[model samples]
Target: MSSLAVRRISECFVKPQFSNQICNLTPWDIVMLSTNYIQKGLLFKKPATLIDEHHFIQNLLEKLKHSLSLTLFHFYPLSGRLVTHKTQNPPSYTVSIDCNNSDGARFIHATLDMTIADILSPFDVPPIVQSFFDHHKAVNHDGHTVPLLSIQVTELVDGVFIGCSMNHSVGDGTSYWNFFNTWSQIFQAQSQSENHEYDVPISRQPIHNRWFPHNCSPPISLPFKHHDEFIWRSETPLLRERFFHFSAESIAKLKAKANSESNTTKISAFQSLSALVWRSITRARSPPSDQKTTCRLAANNRSRMKPPVAEEYFGNCVHAVSAETTTGELLENGIGWAAWKLHVAVTDLNDRVVLEFLEGWLDSPFIIQMGRYFDPYSLLIGSSPRFNMYGCEFGMGKAVASRSGYANKFDGKVSSYPGREGGGSIDLEVCLSPQTMSALESDQEFMNAVTEFDPLLF
Candidate 1:
């Protein structure tokens, strides 16, 4: 089979939801940001501040000065760009983290799909800035705009629901895990106990990111159809929902069974489940030819340090774990067998390939060119060992359902989380086109699974 390396990389305005105007500007007129010499963080207040000027954008400098941690976590050098000069155009947008209830759990709920259709040319700073956040990139400003993660809420099955969108660059399944963990920690009101107390535990030393390559080495040319092709987030009128159960106990048993099935050695539950997802997806869509198909999974290397990159290292620090195989071989091997292959693929993550993969990204500005290759985003397998969605406190009631998906320009998205009420396993959310959704629903093997993921479902 052939393969290619991936490189890197919202908001909304709904007036009925709030009395305030969604945007201070009109439809056609570009926001003329103010040319005022604003101070750092002036544009950003706690939770989020308002955009005062019509043409001004808070620069990287000011964001840092205001809240270094938040800024660092929010802005990245590669994907996230800052406006150095002041503008008369209003700040491209504004963010407000609010809470209506006073519960420990909270959600950073937002609705942002207002677009400018087709405003080309970089010189158009106002419209361009507005569109920049268009490709909601997932990166701590990595040069490439990838690995983005955010949640969206929508109406489905006569009910409102949330969908999550994550760019490949911002992180791997683990990065989400890490971020969620931090989210949960904060929600749990355990921020102080976790040492995130306005803290910058620089740990040892800052590692120069110039160590990784943007994409794979030559001869291994980039794979995929095109760069701009993204699985736009979209919604369907017919709400297809289902749910799965994966208690910690069941997961433990599954882990042991998976390890036992492996010929060589031990592997984590992640690898095992990843195998299940990969195999199931492949089985459902058997390729006409035996050409190898790749199930690219991302790997995170945050806590590997003598002193881990602070939980605050809210940047992209992940690599993909490519699990490849042809339909013929997978069908012959069955689920458990194929899973072991995936296990082998990432078992020794601290290996040369993983290291080099990381080093290559930092070694050059290549990430910029590589971020556009991923789509049909799904957390076929993602978890938050640390996040407490139910515990977030935006001064609102705890989020009954901490959703990580959104309804946007894409067909469908997959999000998995611990069942609604408490913790442990996760819930997988789906957002897809009717055709694809129908196909899955009809496929007896994976029928009616939009609501949940049972390893046996596939």
Candidate 2:
């Protein structure tokens, strides 16, 4: 084998999830990894200061163990292979706190609210501190090339700061939400004199039926899909989050526009917004003269399924919704038509076939292993309305903003309900690549368009 073969083949074991992962670097791997994983993280600022809540932060951690415990899941490496314990285990991430006391002349202790902008800027939090995570993953990997989770914490006097660097192999958004929400409540439980509310009791353990989903095959392990390509890319497409307040009339119009018997029953505000985003993203990168590409959306399935999951059920409960069309056709079709496509994609999510797949996943002892072969480029842009910083009624005031756990990825999240500021909206934390971001921002028309959506643009 060529030296290039070793680089491609050896690194293929980046995670133990995907068995079908290319044994050696093929042209396909190059195209998939380079095009899809190339994007970087974007800055989202939501400035918030921590008040006197040392007790709040402390109490949160202790309660966390009752529901979820943070401990390392030892992935033993034998010879050239790896093995993960076959069980739903405690989280491999830990939480810690960091603080700094700056006393100059300006009365010095004024509270500082960190914004979405500050959170993305790693500089706000020093490297040695960030390295706490670096050390954890480094120590856990133990000279091996498999992924591991090592979480660290930083606490401030005015407030609490969180810094996470987890191996994507272990879990996704659904998994993180379970861990983070539990952690959030732990802290929220503090600053108050009463018991913190955890999730509802588990009523049913979903049966894993691999046979119904596909041909009779052996049950797979965790980490099912290996990462695939970025499904789509544009040399100059920009992405940003601008809070939009819809008038009663406008929202009604959008709702009517999105509503259709074919739609997934009731088209929601998120479904409508998703439709609009798909149109924008697909058209943003128009094909040469007269061509286009496929468009896709991601949906969270916690509530979509029957026997709706409890508020506290932790783990990934999401799947992708894909729609294909050319840039001209999508944008030309207008919002309503595109929304129709989104609805169809989402509606398709309800089929028994979908549930069958979930069963296999739920039953899989080694899900992380199975995910290795999963397509990397498939777009699954998603939203989490549950992104409520203010609803964090755990103890103190609400958070300035809520967002996804991962720093850089095509997937997106937004939370809206109410805010401390009267009817105020929070910014979505977006981490995009520099090139695309610059291109997206340069379009003055796009910037102007955001305001148009905001009737109060004047």
Candidate 1, number of clashes: 105
Per-residue lDDT of candidate 2, residues 141-256 (tens digit) = 22123233222233333333333343232233444444444444544443343543333222232221111133423323224223221222223223343343333344445556
Off by over 4 Å in 1: 1-257, 263-265, 305-310, 362-364, 368-387, 394-397, 405-415, 421-423, 430-436, 442-458
TM-score of predicted model 1?
A: 0.49
Query: Please, what's the RMSD in Å of model 1?
Result: 15.9
Model 1 over residues 341-421: C-alpha lDDT tens digits? 777767656545555644553343132322133333322333333344444332223433432321221223233455534
* lDDT (Cα) of model 2: 0.34
The clash count for each model shown is: 105, 64
Off by over 4 Å in 2: 1-82, 85-151, 155-159, 164-172, 190-266, 303-313, 355-379, 387-389, 393-396, 403-439, 442-458
Specify the poorest-scoring 10-residue window by lDDT in model 2. Answer: 4-13
